[model samples]
Target chain A: MLKGKSILEPMDMTTAELEEIFDLADEIIANPPRFAHACDGKLLATLFYEPSTRTRFSFEAAMLRLGGQVIGFSEPNSSSVAKGESIADTIRTIACYADIAVMRHPKEGAPRVAANSTDMPVINAGDGGHQHPTQTLTDLLTIRRRKGGFENLTVGLCGDLKFGRTVHSLIKALSRYAGVKFVLISPEELRVPDYVRRGVLEANNIPFREVKKMQEVLPELDVLYMTRVQRERFFNEDDYIRLKDRYILDAEKMQLANENMMVLHPLPRVNEIAVEVDSDPRALYFEQAKNGMFVRMALIMKLLGIEVE
Target chain B: MIVNSIERGIVIDHITAGTGNRILDYLKIDTKKNTIAFIMNATSKKHGRKDLIKIENVTDVDLTVLGLLDPNATVNIIENGKIVKKINLELPKTVTNVIKCKNPRCVTSVERNAPHIFHLMDAQTREYRCEYCDEIVSMKNE
Candidate 1:
């Protein structure tokens, strides 16, 4: 049912649809060979208007693993975009050549413009601190696998809540589940925007509390989602420097967390999590990164309507 | 101040006192085509002071724009100097190209010929979020 659909935000897919993608991801994980040829004759075009390492690679790897051909520009300067091509024109041209397209742009809603411009399924990789639905998918998949289900779980999202698109998307996605509570840990300057707080959480009547310190809520959490305070998102370097190191998840902080609490981070993490924590069974960020590829594979298949036995 | 009522025209009443000119400019009602009486800061029992507009032989003003500009404003259809239809304005669900999103990081800010779009998020606060960037914009002075 997700066929030919563009994923612009986490809320675009219903819970049932999300489960469908996750279930497929689970199957692919259990037996990768089964879905290897799912996209045998298809092509995936990656349009990264901004610099990226993980998202681009994972998307490319996902397509390659699915027996699909990949074509795209890692840098916008190499493409027609450098010639001042609009997103609409670029996407419209891409639709003719590729079966599906994934876009990551510095401008918020750039992918949305692309999605609306073409019939080819568009995936928003990350759009200028806006919604990153793919990262949300990866996070949800990791949480589901680790915690069994989303209900009645206290999710502590620590650091840079304001510009962390992954945290915003995850919060919105998780708010749909029953009895889910949010412990938002961020400096007052980096608090989640009004739309996420008032429009998503408060409007949905989700239980949540905003705190300046992560340790205050660490023990009560079922999941701790860590984020880096992105320098690119800030207008002032002084503000970024002041807030960047506000919350770091070290070995000492890990001891205060619940034994079963899983630590997740959308990676390329800049020292927010200590290297020592990686050895802990609870640190699932690396595995979460791997799951990002698998989930994207499933998503590409679902969007392309490629059935796999 | 009593503005002459018009037959076969429209009457927009109870606009927040100071915003009448802005709303009039937004409506872009041609002054040469239709005779318009703009009454600003007029004394009123209901609003203490209000702005009212009467346009002769024009009744097709976009209510949505009017609603967004000033939701408290009332639109009255006049026929033969008698009120035929009165519209109570509500916040529009979506508006296109009415107000530009000020967020520099938004796609609409750079994209060529991108239509400025916003959707109502909080009607009580009159908050409209940009369709692209999700930046909240209040219609007051926009």
Candidate 2:
């Protein structure tokens, strides 16, 4: 059912659809070489208007592992975008050569624009901190793999909830699962947007509570998803300095967390997570990044309707 | 309440009580030189709660915006007070440069040169979505 579909938002896929992708991802992980040629003749076009080496490489590697061809530009400067071509024109041109396209743009609705322009399935890699559906898929796969299932879990989302698109996507994806509650940990200034709270959580009648300190809810969490709070998001240096240390995750803080609790970070961590906690067996961030490839591989295979060997 | 009725001007009616102030604020009606009358919190048989704004010396008002903000608003353009043009301010197919999309990551929010564009996905529901970010604007909140 995922065939010929474009994943522009996390909610685009239902809980059943997500489970199917996770099942395929598990197959890919279990017998990596068996499904290598799933997309032998298909091509993946990565049209990243913004610079995201991690995401770009993940898509290319996923395609390569699937025995598929990868083609496209890393930045807009090297593509027709530099010559004043709109995203619509760029997607149209890319769709001619690729079976599917993965796009990352600095504009919030850029991928949506591209999705409308091309016949090929358009996956939104990231769009100006708006929504990152692939990352959400990766997270869901990781959670399912690590925790056995997504239901009845208490997930704590900490740090810059306001601008963290991944957090928004994850929350939306998780809301579909049963008995899942959220402990939103962030400063008042960095709370999740009203629309997200109203549209996704409150509208769904999901149980959630907001708190300024992470320690208060650490022991109750089955998963701790942390994000960096950039200094740039704040207008004043004094406010940034005051709040910077409060959100940092250190070994001491992890002691207060549940012993079986897993910690996740969407990486490029800037002192938000201490190095000491990296050795913790529950630190699944690096593994989370690796899951990005497998999940994408499953996505490409399913979207292209390629049967696994 | 006797500003000469428009020969060809819009009369917005059945607006929710006290919302005329917001409509006035949104349109900046005072800045224009046209004759206008704003009737607030008036009783009506059609709409249990009603308000009216009558603008004279103008042919048309942006009914799309009015509908976006308040779908119940009915517009009647009078030519010699005979209701020459009557339109129940339906949601437009496309809206441009009216309200700001609150999503910070929206291209239209940050891009100074780009026009703020929105599409009316649900006409009766008064749902307007940013063309750039696909962020749905809730009129009740705005």
Candidate 3:
């Protein structure tokens, strides 16, 4: 049923559909070679209009692992986009060559435009801090794999919650599950947007509390998701410098956290998590990145309607 | 005062008395260039207080925003002193280049080159959303 569907936003996929993808990902993880030739003749077109080495490589690796070929540009300067081609024209032309497409553009709704232009499935890698549904999926899969299920878990989200697109997507996605509470850890200036708080959390009647310090809620969290507070997002450099050190998760802070609490980050991290924390068994960012490939592979296969033997 | 007859023009009727200026401000209508007549605080059977703007040389006006701002505004185009075309302005399907989206981070708010685009998602509710930021702008909020 997910075949020919476009994954543009986190809300685009229902709870049931997300569970199905998770199931597929679990199957793929348990038996990797089973889906090796599932997409043998298929081609995945990765149209990254922005510079994203991590996301582009993840999509390519997902396709290659599934026995599919990858083709497309990482930056718009190298493609016909430099020649003033519209997103519609580029997607339409690429659809002729590729069976599916994954795009990352600086413009919000660019992937939606691409999806509207072509019949092929268009996956939104990231759209100008608007939405990143796959990263949400990666987080969900990581949580499910680590914690066994999503129910009755206290998840703590820290760092730049205001401009963090992944944090927004994760909150929306996780709110659909049962008995999940949120501990929003961020500065007052970087609180989650009102629409998200109203539309997703409050509308769903999900319980959440906002706090500035992560250490206060550290021991209570089953999952701790951290994001980098970029210097660009802050208006004052001094404030960024002052607050940056407090938000960093060193081993001392990790000692105060729950023993079973899993630490996850949507990398490329910029010193938010200490290197010592990476050695902890609770640190799952590396595994989180690997899960991105498997989850995307499940998504690509399911969207393309390729039945695995 | 003096009643002026027009052979051909448009007559906007039933506008709330004090809102006539706001309607003009919204439309950016130039009274200096056009032969325009505005009667303020006029008595009406339906409305206790009303205003009317009659334009002698103009037949068509942009009714999209007018309807959004004031749905009760009625437009009557006259030809040879007889009403030829009558239209009751209604909310448009899509609105562009009008009220600014208040969200500072919205692309439409910061980008001068981009036209402010809004769509009337809930007509009965009278809710409009910025096409770029998806922020709902309500008449009550204005």
**Best candidate, DockQ:** 1
| TM-score (all chains, Cα) for each model | 0.94, 0.79, 0.80
Q: Give per-residue CA lDDT, model 2, range B1-142, as digits (tens).
A: 4345666677888898878888877776654687888888777888776788888777655555776667778778778768876786666688777767887767655444456777765544556777766688855555
Q: How high a TM-score does candidate 3 get?
A: 0.80
What candidate 2 gets wrong by more than 4 Å, as runs, is A231-243, B1-66, B69-72, B75-104, B109-142
For candidate 2, the lDDT comes to: 0.83
Off by over 4 Å in 1: B1-5, B28-51, B140-142
Report how closely model 1 matches the true complex, as a DockQ value: 0.80
Model 3 spans > 4 angstroms off = A232-243, B1-67, B71-128, B136-141
Worst 10 residues of 1 chain B by lDDT: B1-10
lDDT of 3 by residue, A102-122 (tens): 998766556776786789999
DockQ-sorted candidate list, best first:
1, 2, 3
Model 3 chain A lDDT-worst window of ten:
A105-114
- Model 1 lDDT tens row, A1-309: 899999999999999999999999999999998877888889999999899999999999999999999999998889888899899999999888999999999999999998888888999999998899999999999999987889999899989999999988999999999999999999899999988998899999999999998887889999999999999999999999998888889999999998999999998899999999999999999999999999999999999888875
